[model samples]
Target chain A: MDQFDSVVQLLDSNGSVVANSQFTSTLSQSELLGFYRDMVLVRTLDEQATALQRQGELGLWAPLLGQEAAQIGSARAMQKQDFAFSTYREHGVAWCRGVDPVDMLRFWRGTMHQGWDANHYRDYGYQIIIGAHALHATGYAMGAQLAGRVGSGEAEKDQAVMAYFGDGAMSEGDVNEAFVFAASYQAPVVFFCQNNQWAISEPTRRQSRTPLAQRAVGFGIPGIRVDGNDVIACYEVTEHALHRARSGQGPTLIEAVTYRMGAHTTSDDPTKYQLFSDVELWRERDPIKRLKIYLQTKGILSAELETQLAGEASALAQRMRDECRELPDPKPSSMFDHVYADTDINLEKQRAEVEAILIQSMEN
Target chain B: MAQLSIVHAINQGLRRAMDSDSKILLMGEDIGKLGGVFRVTDGLQKDFGEERVIDSPLAESGIVGTAIGLALYGYRPVVEIQFDGFVFPAFDQIVVQLARMRYRSAGALTLPITIRMPYGGGIGSVEHHSESPEAYFAATPGLRVITCADSNDAYWMIQQAIASDDPVIFLEPKRRYWQKGEVNIEANMSDALNMYSAKVLTQGSDCTVIGYGPTVATCLQAARFAADDGVKLEVIDLRSLSPIDMSTLVESVNKTGRAVLVHEAPGTGGIGGELAARLSQACFYKLEAPVMRVTGYDVPYPPSRIEDDYLPDAERILDAVEKSMNY
Candidate 1:
């Protein structure tokens, strides 16, 4: 467990550089600023989504309140061809993948299960079944290996796959099976675990006696632990892992040590189980706050820039709210669509029967 | 046309499908080298190479969940579950993930996956090897459950299932794997009846006997025995269990005025129960008696010594026919 102990961090909580950092020289000032901006934007989106849920605009919302860097940094590390399988809470990752915030709300509003086409963004939609997508990512990586799209010497020609899950998901059978298959096949995939401290009222300790990253060694896969609040560390580690996967070095396990500042979901009440002190302790290591501090200390953040970003976030949130309100009600017949690539005669008959019953009820 | 066992026919069907499509791959435990416990996949690995005919690790969920990923990546993966009872470990992946992906994605993704499992009893296997789990899969909304009674359908349906855009649960009767029948190698894909349709194996006028998978042969035998007793019985092989070819069943029941449903699964809440209820409603005016079902008792499959007694045989089916005639 201690082999990967040193949590790779380029920036400390107080916005000071750690002298022996590997990513400090690699990341440019503008790119660092961009990371900071993206983190703040995602945090703002999280807050708005939570507020919408409270007001009944959404059925539920899983807030990515404190794990912005873990999601954004790793998501930004992927090449255009690389694919990601995400759990439902990775709103930060979705934002980084260029999925419009409003489009993500359709599912929460009960309009549809998936709000966007996975093919359009090269990223799978939110997988609600915990840890299931890990196997999917491993299998997709195997497919890439078979297609001669993986293990190429050139990075551009190689495609790597990534799966995002919470610490709780490490205990799931699907995730464990994924580890076995990924390692045995030497699949070109990365298992990104955001150890966000709490899974509904249960802490990470309840799920594992050892750190999650150490579990990778048993599967014969290399594991890396990083300070999730440090955006630079997250980006650097993810880029290195993805490069290894692309170059056919096989899979990597990344455990991003982070905290969730809010309830697990809109319906959850963290005050019932977690201590306020614990939340306060994590508040000091806020991913967005640390990056903002780093940008300010570097003379990259100005008063005018802060005001402009705040305005942009508010405008985007407002547009999302308006669009969500105007979303059309679901049609009963639409359920019959897409059940199969080609609907058979029996399904068509059932659909018609349902339509007739619905029409009869409406007329009466 | 040539005489072949159901096992060899399936092997030929698999080989033909793989030969035609580069994206078709096979994965299962012991399927590559050992040629499956049933040897249904014999020589496939040698002919197709280990890459295409992969011998997967011994995790059922891993087999199915990874197959989902492979399907998403544009490969039509045909996974063998080894046996009927072992499929439970993969039940979550099949019921929750593979069955729901296309509907959840709203057509954004299609899983052309074929999960083949040797099902049912009478070969005297150990515990957890003889369960007929067709009802559980047929109850699932997004899946297509299919079973074959002869070498011809076994050969054709395996290829059709691989060609289908939807996920299919292809159930093979383990006890009937060696049943010999004629297989037409020249049959065209477009000409064969859609795999979902039922087949009237024998025509008669006195009564209708409906069965699928393992019980189809029993019903055919019952019909042959009924012939000597001055009673002609119509035997219908329900090829597809889910979107059950109701038209054929309704027509048969309409003409016969009585129908007998047979299955090896437990009687209560079985496919027989569902078909009996539906046929009663569909053939209400034409029926002479209640739709009768000759099924295994609502109990766990017993020891191999009494396996014939546990499973519905020609006698039990004939008894049901006699009871229906009296009604």
Candidate 2:
């Protein structure tokens, strides 16, 4: 209805396009197949992680069961120099960024401070405080804009950022403040909200009266609602948004209308609140399945290639399951290391006390 | 040396830092147009333009969180958390993100962020305005906490604080913001006393009275009053609260065997307790008394009329000195 005139096509659950778009030619059969494979791999990893927690291997797991396309598609669309800030539920995006899926267990298992090395992937560590990273993305974008990093002629010279959060994060005071700051500064960044409808117990309806994307209009940035399960839709939207940012057009908020097909975390039981039928309805719209069907219909995927991909994905999942089970719990004294860079008397004293306790426990 | 207030001193430090580093930024509520409630950040927005001096929304957490991003991008952001009471809202961002960012990155990333909070009581304002929250940060790991007793210390210490590569929680004594002193504007910022070392403001043979921020003035006054009573009191200003200036404290406690620690924060788990424990270990042999303390009672800072009772006054400090001397 808005800007990307022919861009917002709603692909039906049966792999038939109910509406069409001019950007369809922008994607090739190989890219479409690649996106599907990534989604399937992520979904497989999410399932394995959930089972790992249930089997007492991990302390917790945030299953990105349904929002795989929104994360993987957008993550693959960006240039390497462009940075990313993600909330806790961006495992799929982390996978696209080349973060070891097993490393994420280190944080949930309380074995490490963060999932992976931040600089390794330019993935600024996963933020637990909802929407706090949104502002960081805004600030970094403003910094990039100032250094003449935006519209630098060379594609590598243009740097923008993408901030990912959920519907629950939209209600946070910091997220709204990020909107204000981004708008005022006209910082080149994309505020990507995977509106998966539930903030633990609360739904998206409770967080916003209008749609989450519509709120971006108030910030003077363009907003769009995309078919989140549609991998092509997510990639096209994110790529175009990044282009606008690099062109110094400022921020854009994309509300990927997806669904959470699994529990919020290993500790949460969605059965306590949400209806099971809703999950079933969304499962039919599984991002991987739609893409697979589209690929199969287009004769882009052969049974042999699909079997090989699934086998590889399954083997990777098994290795993750095995590695997570054998992963060592952190040494108790290591907790003091990250508290401060310089030696602190109070922390040293506390560490000594903790060491004494842990040693005593070991003797028992 | 031109005389300037602590407010002006901090203003000079900010101006100098911004002039030195193009990446240095100043942000907070009313820090832009209205300067600041205390005018410590006054004239910054006008001098540096809006990008360098930002007037943010009323959310403290947002200010600190975004500041972390700015720091990650190689900008040194100096934030003003209007008052002590308002710091709690940003405690999550400051402690969890800003404080932990450097360590989380394993020294790969630098968070040269300075959080300037106008702290301590005594300006006779409404509730939540005059509270001593330094101990909270002092207990928090990964944060370097520091405060100044006077304008000279404020001018040099603030620049030193901003220049540090680590995140610093800089506490400004609101009550003493208007106190005037000689601040050599031309003096090298790092030439003053070491940031981690405490200073012996006054020397005496009787007892050591330790305090910082607004309480340093009160402690000095108490020392003077004690002198009238024939009690020669030594005063120590703890400039750095976290990596505490223990050497100066140990030296003084050993010289003056009897010691009295003072602060406006509650008596329990106060900086006084931490100092007492350290000095106890460091100067146990020289002690003439089980170190005494004069501090606010373990209760919320009360109304202005009752704040006299809640905050340790010079009389109470002298009383503690007498008690320690008696022991």
Candidate with the greatest lDDT versus the true structure: 1
Best by TM-score: 1
Shift of residue B266 alpha carbon in model 1, Å: 20
Q: Please write out the lDDT profile of model 1 over residues A228-284, one tens digit for every residue.
A: 988888998999999989989999999999998888777566775578998899899
List where candidate 1 sits over 4 angstroms from the true fold.
A21-25, B1-327
Model 2 achieves a DockQ score of: 0.02
TM per candidate comes to: 0.57, 0.56
Q: What's the lDDT for candidate 2?
A: 0.82
Q: What is every candidate's alpha-carbon RMSD to the true fold?
A: 19.2, 18.0
True contacts kept of each: 0.00, 0.01
Error of 2 at A350 (Å): 4.2
Give the per-residue lDDT of model 1 (tens digit) for B188-253. 988888999999988999999999988998999999999999899999999999789999999999
Error of 1 at A363 (Å): 3.0
Q: Which parts of model 2 are misplaced by more than 4 Å?
A: A1-7, A18-22, A349-364, B1-327
- Model 1 CAPRI rating: incorrect
